[model samples]
Target: MKKYSALLILGILFLILAACGSNDNSESSGGSGDSAPASNGNASSEKENQEEPAITNAIIRVAMKSEVDSLDPYQASATDTGIMMDNVFDGLFDTDENGELIPNLASDYQISEDNLTYTFTLIENATFHNGEDFTAEDVVYSYSRLAGLETGEPLSDKWAVVENVEATGDYEVKVTLKSVDSGFLARTIIAILPEGYEEQETHPIGAGPFKFVDYRPGQSLLLERNDDYYMEDKVPQAAEIEFVLMPDTQTAVLALQAGDIDIIPGVNAQQLMQLDDSVTTLSGPSNMPVIFGLNHAVEPLNDINVRKAINLAIDKDEIINTVMQGSATKIDSNFSPAMAFFYEDSVEGYYETDVEAAKELLAEAGYPDGFDLKMTVPSHATMYTDSAQIIADQLGKANINVTLDPVEWSTWLEQVYTDFNHESTIIGLTGKIDPYDVLIRFVDGYSRNFINYNNAEYNEMIEKAILETDDNERATHYKRAQEILAEDAASVFIMDPDSNTVMRDGVTGLKHYPIGKLNLEDLSITK
Candidate 1:
């Protein structure tokens, strides 16, 4: 076995650990970028004068990438489910148009001097979808379910640091954390539900701008404007919203062209090329990292050499240009470059395309002939399937046989993400404003750690990042954590796919969230 010298290892770490500061309000923090046509701009505008259009319905039809798995806020981890949850549930805090964390359920909050405790004052007159008065108890109940503060069976560690949540007054809730975490506020985006109603999966009740109407399995979901919503000015401009599930991107494109669907919040670059002038696109900032995740618990993938070989065999630029149609920027680390604080430019070219080198590494791992690997891809998103094909082609050059298995969104969620039942998969992980959101998933035993990645050194660095009080020191720890993943080739890091939303010409006021959500609350029709 070869041993790395301490000084040599230190030198490499120093080179990658340079200060990469982040601006609090950078686009990476969250929210959509400027609204401009992603493709042929305003080509469909000419038809606007040609027809009198139908405006009597007052309903905006949206095309979702997949059928929603569950309305239960605790169970949903995918983007499609998050989209629906965004409308049905309101978090204690949410991002503004500029990506800054602002108050939602809690009108104002005060943090302790040590940053370990948070006291929140709820808004008066806020009511739930069922007309129940929203209070501090609801906040405590919702967060308790999310953080498992009281319940032993916690949903996710996304808010694991939350020690306790108690309602001191009718409209006041105080939360105490185990430690001081800078990103804790951003994680507060979890939906606040009524107490004891946490078990409701099929039917979700929350205080938001929209109210659930009906949901048909494998078909569509309908939501209507919540007339009792406290935020009158921000209420839905459209009377109703229908989210139609389109499993295939081609089918979705056809639907958009045929005027059956008014908007597709996220359209890949390849699909963007197919749309004509009639569709308007808003190209915005997205922190979602499309990764070729490998289950470290799996046989061949358990070998670091095999992982590095797989990473080197494929060309990221080629994938970006060909599969993404030059819409995305190649990323070597988990955090996007748009995220100024923890993203390091030096890590951009960590692994280069070296098919022969990859083959040699496989030979070193006792597989000179290479081996067959199955890549489970979710069929709902074209980016996943399209990128999977291109990746399979690239790996083929190194004699690695990749069998592309396309599965439905629900199947992929249960089998691939939740169960860790596959060898490899292609998927995107949406990031939050905080660097913790991106790094915490890679922790040894995190619920969201579907890839089953476990590294002692990585875990140590993350722990330090969480506890570090100094801004520069915290960022340095985050940089080291990313370096560990890159050095180990934790996953085949891919680009942060450009967030592209396609909406018909008649749709007005549609916007995209940087955290990867379509804001329909302010949407309306001009036709």
Candidate 2:
């Protein structure tokens, strides 16, 4: 019996070795088996069971004029910068497809009876890309970091209302404000950073659908989809997203035409008109207002009559038609048409081609001899150059000698904000959802307020409107503020041009936001 058992074990071992050798040979030969029908049948069955593509593997190439400066949302200075950060990082609250504020990181939020306090309840399943669970601590960390109470540069005016933020529970945060701010909800559009986020020096970990893969400064930023994202159902259509930075609009347009890029966000009017039929243009009413900014610190600008003369001198209709190429519409007030309640039609605009009236105002301001003024502008931007030339021509008609000083954007921003080298310049400002945001950034005591146009009464009214809980009263206050700005002629409220985006034929599911963000999550390549 022992001899028989030994023989059987040897036979079993030989069989196992033979099977393994056959399997290895099959793999090596690329599964080419003619002798065994069963093996061939098994191979066919396995091939049929393979899953189809998830539509997430397709990479969508996009073109942008300016490179994303910072991944940190709170520190973003430009619209493109904010858009890039927004894609990889979500805020506690975000606007939905319908342009309404909806919950994002926070499951639900509520305001206190006095409107001075806000409570946010976090979603239990929300987790950062690093697998760290989100909590109220993260919210506190983000807000504090943005307020520059920690490591970031301070945004004093934006954070002035916040008294303190406390983690009342593990997933609940209560923020107590120094005063009631009606614009608090709108301001919460900033991205929420993770707790102890400052520890990360190289990259940031976010709870967004996409993760930052790499960034080549002045070149491009690469992002990949997060497979472990909490909302997998709303997954991005692409496996990877590449933001190739083409600073020059002409070069960007050429690249798009050559099929080197799929989309460009900041294509000017001339570039759009030159695009071939292969690309489709998407445009909408933007919050940005193109205007002529006056340096109130300058001698003549300090005089109301001089400011009014400058405002009356320009022919906005001609500028919009010629320089903007009919892509823009003349706006009477700084407030956008989208802001229905705050935008008062009663606030008259200076659109008429009143060369005679302009001359009259200039002469009335004791400039009958026509004074010479230096106008500084960013050379790269087409709109600024064209507007400056138009204004210079019109001012010449009024006998005002205007010298155009076109400089690079960096140099222009520095001189305009700090040096105050020039008396006036033509520029575009990205409008905010609320009137206070516009007023605070431009008219209030902020860095953008190089114009030095300030009124205690106007400021007080803006403050009241922001803190007022009643919607009707808030609208009334905002209207009054707009009236004050228009009456003073502190800034020339030029055209509010429509934002446009050109895309290739295959790209679909892309949507336009009023804020000018090109959302790519819903986009897919049908071709």
Candidate 3:
């Protein structure tokens, strides 16, 4: 299905380009005075044709519950931001619908036998949205900036494995790794930017199927088709795409029903139940892990017993059924099932709802009457805050007082996520196709580890996993890392939220990648 969708879009784009070329040739030939002059009737017909609308093209309006914090690909961390950037930027590689990494900007790549070095040959004639020619120097600069080669804060911990990125030739680049990282190739999905990406704070330009046209924060982001896109075959079918910010899922569903919006990236189960036959729904397991993060820096939560007590108090099954509406799967570890080789299924069912045992554990941790804990959950979705409420009630039975503090998405990202100043938070850790991308967060001193979950054993295991070249050996290390988290009750494990997209019945070509991105390049509207 994925291949078919891509190929069909390619064929359509080829036809569009061919017709454009034909028009150019005709205009050049007909403008010569050597040719016979057109009659008045012919001139009038040409004016009428100029005034006609391009009915073959489309403009798709997608709705999202929250607005993006940043449009910069390197700084974006939320699902909505990722989706927006995915359209405006072209990465070195992109995963298929099944999460297998494939070449995108790079025509082909090679890995050394020892797995310490990787070489890539760039696609010739590729140009950024600003018409700047792309070359290996741009790739080197992007990677260097991401890896903090200049001695500043890195954009993401995902770049920690890179030793250095150097351009060997105008169209060739080589990346030397500090160690053998099996997941490094997949993690190269980070979008390649122009040589200098600093000035793109307000608007970003990249070699993508679409170009940034306009953006109004808290309102809508507009993108237009990039006629000069590197992969001409991947030129967006939609002449324009408008991502409108929705206040909530209810408003979005209403818009879908009223024909105000064409699609919603994530439609909850309740919202799905409310939609009529006019809406078409598509669903799959998401790579994101919705976790109840407990800040280990806090007083009582610092104790493993308290963390275990809190973990055992809540019933994951109830949360999965009642709160999630059976649209998710219960997970005991941080790893999701979407990560085929590394996920450990047997680790589940280790902790069941046992109020008495939880009480005993809390008492043992010097919290007999249950200490108060402040939990801040992002107000992005009702599911998150509702799950926090249910968890508060469950912990209350074990005499653990949890205060629910709901904040806006921006505030949550600033306070709980960036600053790491909160006692606890309920947020989803969006995963990438690579296992290392998700596992790197739990490493000591990781910027994204806002919960301050630090364990020497966990950090060591993750490091070992990164250096291991063999697939099975790396899996063993990853499994051990998960086992350590489970044993220590690192976080209140939640479920992998199901990705449910609700679109108009005639909407087609909206591909849902397992990593929770909506591939809108090929999206089209049909009556």
Candidate 4:
């Protein structure tokens, strides 16, 4: 059966290639430039008219999988919500298209010689969506509110390194750190809330390109373009943006194909393959890692041999090929190829599928009969569930009994991190544009290390790497940490699939940013 499937896939690839050759005219539907129109006829003219519009009145309908948990920027965990909030709110610093840190709310920032303190000079003309002039006090207020002393949610662990955040002047905010942390700048990617946001959770205000208009819980979120935006000079072409929540991928894809939604930010691999050529597909490296997290503190997994066996049992290539439909690249390490540094080629991937070896290891660990295991997964995460199924099936081939318990994302997160048990589960780790961004959250034992898998040796090494100012030494320490993680089988690393976004051909100026963000500022639609 596998042989027949392989042959069918080869034949399909050949047919696709042959079709590509004959469809040259269809391939060149639009001009080859960032500003080029996706469709012909009056598109250029319509865009030109909107360029200097008598009234900037255009709506962009976007389909997303889930609604946001909280409007408070510091409290958001879902990427779907993060992307929306990120565009609607400005941070102290923002990453450009190339993933390089650039000034946003902060015009200029200076780090002290000791690197423990950073001072940011806020832009003078910036204002919140509510028309309040943005001041250094707003920055101080934003950070202080997330510090758990006020919000009591304990979401400010990312900024816990900062000892103090004070307004030195009308436009200058000074932040003092407990120690020199490498991820300080990237961590600033967290959206900054307007003053008194804790009291105004229902009506959050931000200094971003778009302002919050209305939000119907579990249905949709509406945002109107900020006409009086600080960066109005470089206005986002759309007049208003609507984020409509759809529960599943099939519905999201159907909405996009039916022209009900102009954009689907994150499209699943299977859905991307099924999309028509008329739809513009953007592919980029996702700064996320998919892994089967093991609870080493619990039984069965406490044995390193059992963990190693499970890692070797599942075939990552098969998962990427069958489950992901070749949309993903099999990954050996935690870092994505998008991250320029620390993605060492020498790091070997553990993708070898060997049922015999897995069984041998299980037997060596006194489980020759193959023990029963339960895997917890979120139904919303299609890819994670698919990967889990593949792993479960593969384990069954080795005489291992596996059961899948799928739950909602909220319940899954709560169980996986806080109330973790011996049950193995599949979850994805994202938000690692920089290596430090990953280390601070995963390895440093500070934030989101939800499984509570901590080692003093690992923590010491991570701390040393963060404090080390030398780039080379930091890289070395990070590499050591990654190697230790792989050797210890902390988690079964899976492939990092290519991130996908599907938009109609009529949509223009949709640029792919490296950090998995859709910059709709320059986007425009023309019939």
Candidate 5:
């Protein structure tokens, strides 16, 4: 293992992000370098053409990558599911156009001097979709259930450090953590439902800019504007928005060209090439790590030699150029370079394409002839399936027999992500405002530890990263964790796929978030 004797110390753990690779994460984060198009420059002209440029009741049809797996805010697992949850649920905190954490249900919040306690002043007029008033009790119910204080079955460690949650007043809630954690604000962005609201599986309710209308399996999810929303400034511009499931990128591109769909979010570079001048690309910042995951619980994968051999077997540069058409940022560590707070760039080019060396490593692991491995890919996301095919061929060169198992996104979520019933898979992990959310998934016993990786040194580093107050020291701990993941070959950390959204030339109000959500609150159509 190489030592990072000369570590680049980075401060400002705050993930105030805008475009994908910009120096600053401000409102104008997306610049010409990111290939992001200029803002709604013709917005004024379009307004003159219509009495209401931002139509109050206009419908903006969107493309969903897959069927929404679950309506429950807690069940948002994939990109499409997050998209659905973004509209139906409003959390205690929300993200701005540049991905900065902002007040949502909580109008204002104060952190204690020690940073262990958080006092929030809730929005008084906020109402749920079911016409229920949102209060501090609802916050207690939602967070307590997530922390396992209410259900007696802890779903996540989102509040693991939290010692208590109490409602001091009808509109005031205070959270006291055991220790200081600067990144605690990121966890507050998930949905805060009404107290004891449990019909989320069949029907969902929240206090976002939009209300649920209907959802048809394998078809679409419909949402209408929430007229009673407390935040009038951030109200939905369109009266209705429909998320139509379109798994195939080419088909979705065609639909967009035919004016059947208003927008296609997260389109790949190849799909961008297919669109003509009628539609423009809103290329924005992204911090997702598209990984070729290997379950450590599996037989051959449990062996570190086999894992390292698999890592050396494929060429990441080839995959990026062939499948992504150089539209992605090649990442060697689990973290993306866009998140400068913890991203370790020194590990880049650590593993070169060495097929013979990979074969030798396989022989060292007692597998003279590489064993067969099945890679489960979610078919809904074209990037995963397309990259899976290329990865299979690449691994085959080192005598590793590869088979592709493409499943629906929902099935992939349950089987691969939740059930831990897969050998290997290819998927993209979205980002958050804090590095904790990204690193926690790799913890051995974490709910999302589908990879089944376990390393004592790596685990200890992460534990220290969370507890460490000094930004330099905390980032150092995180850096070591990233180095360990690369050296240990935990997974084939690929690239941060550039976020590109396709929209008609005149359509505006498209903004890219660092967290990679296709927020539709500002979307509107203009002729």
Candidate 6:
């Protein structure tokens, strides 16, 4: 798209050059009016016969649930922020239109005989947004910081296995892992930065298809095209992408109708029906599962019987058909079936709905009259609030008095997620390409395990799954880990709804990955 913008500017310059050359030719004719009259007549006739060229409008406006919590890739918490960063930063590896693993910064690589070390040959000629040459040292810095070498605490537990990282050559990076992982390729897509850039969290810079322009909290984020991107062929097609915060679905649908926005991602089926004929829709299964998360450390929920009763009371199939309009996949565990390679249907139909049985379980747990429960939910999207209402109604049927508490996204993030101060909450656990990334948040001792779930056997299974180098062996361990989560009734597992992407008349090119992320490079818009 940026290429087309450059070509259009050049075409206008060419027209100016032609007019100047005509004047020069006429001046060289020694003030003769003969050639001037003929030239003017031809120009007029040409203008009358030929139509003007149409300039393409290469810009797209997308909707965001809220402002990006952080600009730094390693520190970002909001899903929308991660999507924005994917366009502003280039990773060592990236996914294709079909969501397959492909090289981005690193051209190729080799693994050691014991499968503990990987040496990557970086691609030369790639430069950062600050005009610095990208080298292996930058990769080392990013990986080292990720593993708590720079900071006392690791930002995420997923990268805790990285034992060592060093620059073997200017463009060669070597990384040694504490354990063997067959799914480590997906982890290679982390954002790469300069060796010592300090303002990344405030004013970020990267060698991506897009560059950060401006951001305003609760309003919008603006990004401009990177014309000098390393891979010219893969430059973003859109000249600019503006993420407009649209916390309300109805308001966003109105914006799309008024031609103020070009796209609204993750729209439900009901929202799609409100649009007219001047729109296109792309639908596919999303890896994120809408879960009713229970606090295992809280009262009543700490008991296994009470947790099982809650799980048995809520009907997942009804939520899929009614709340999701039959557009979601019924999930029994944390792992989504969209990632078929590592997913197994081991716990399917395990908890059939029985309200009487749920009440009996409550009675067995010494809560015959049922206890009062407060469900904290984020009110950014009706997708969550609506489901919470239905689930709350379902729980009430089992004689469990429920109180609905809807809070803003930020408050929910701070209190319910970070503080873990609530009994239960409704949230979507976004998926990643790797299986471990999906389940790591629930594992014991994990910093992000806010659910407070602790099981020795489950932790041991996760350890075995990550260390096993063989694919089949790892699958066995992962499947058992998921089964353990189900047997313990860790949480009320919901459905993985289809990602419905709504675009205006001229917008196109939306890709679906195994992870929950959006890439704006392939999207194009026409005037």
The per-model lDDT (C-alpha) reads 0.73, 0.64, 0.72, 0.65, 0.74, 0.72
Ranking by lDDT: 5, 1, 6, 3, 4, 2
Candidate 4 clash pair list: none
TM-score of each: 0.88, 0.85, 0.88, 0.86, 0.90, 0.88
Q: Residues 1-527, candidate 2: write the lDDT tens digits.
A: 01121112122112111211111000000000001001120011112212343365877777755545456665445455556656777777665433455567777676777878888777777888788888899998877765666544556567867777889999988888888887776767667778876633358678887888888887888888877777767678788888886656678778877878876665556676686766765555554666687778787778777777777777888887787667565775666655555665677664355667766776777777778888887665566777789989887887778999987655665677545567887766664545677667555576557667787767877888887877778778878877777788877887666555667766665565545355667666654
Tens-digit lDDT track of model 4 for 57-128: 778888776566667666566666666766688887766554556667877777788888878777899888
RMSD (CA, Å), candidate 3 to true, equals 12.9
Q: Which stretches of candidate 3 lie over 4 Å from their true place?
A: 1-55
Q: In candidate 2, residue 147 scores what lDDT?
A: 62
lDDT of 6 by residue, 1-527 (tens): 01121112222112111211111000000000000011121121111212333223377888766667788888777666777677899888875433455778988777788878888888998998888999999999998988876675666777777888999999999898888865565678889988899898888898888998988888988998888898877677788889998877678789999999887766777777777767766555556766788889899899999999999999988887777777777887887676665776978777888999999999999999999999997777676778889998999999888899998777776787677789998777765666777777788877767678998988988888777766667778888988988899998888766666667765655554545456677665554
Give candidate 2 regions above 4 Å deviation: 1-54, 148-154, 199-202, 417-422
Candidate 3, 1-527: lDDT as tens digits: 01122112222112111211000000000000000101121011111223333334788888866666777777765666777668888777776565555567887777787878888877887899888999999999999888887766566676766889999999989998877776677667778999976767788888888889888988999999898877767777788889898857788888888888987766667777787866666665655677899988888888999999998898988887886677676788887766666777778877888999999998888888988999987776777778889998988899878889988777887787778889988777765655677777778898878778889988988888778766677778888888888899998878776666667766665554556466777665564
RMSD of each: 8.4, 18.9, 12.9, 11.1, 6.5, 15.7
For residue 403, model 1's alpha carbon misses the true position, in angstroms, by 2.1
Leading candidate by TM-score: 5
In model 3, how large is the Cα lDDT of residue 284?
58
Between the candidate structures 2 and 6, which one is better when assessed by TM-score?
A: 6
* Model 1 segments more than 4 A misplaced: 1-57
Write down the TM-score for model 2.
0.85
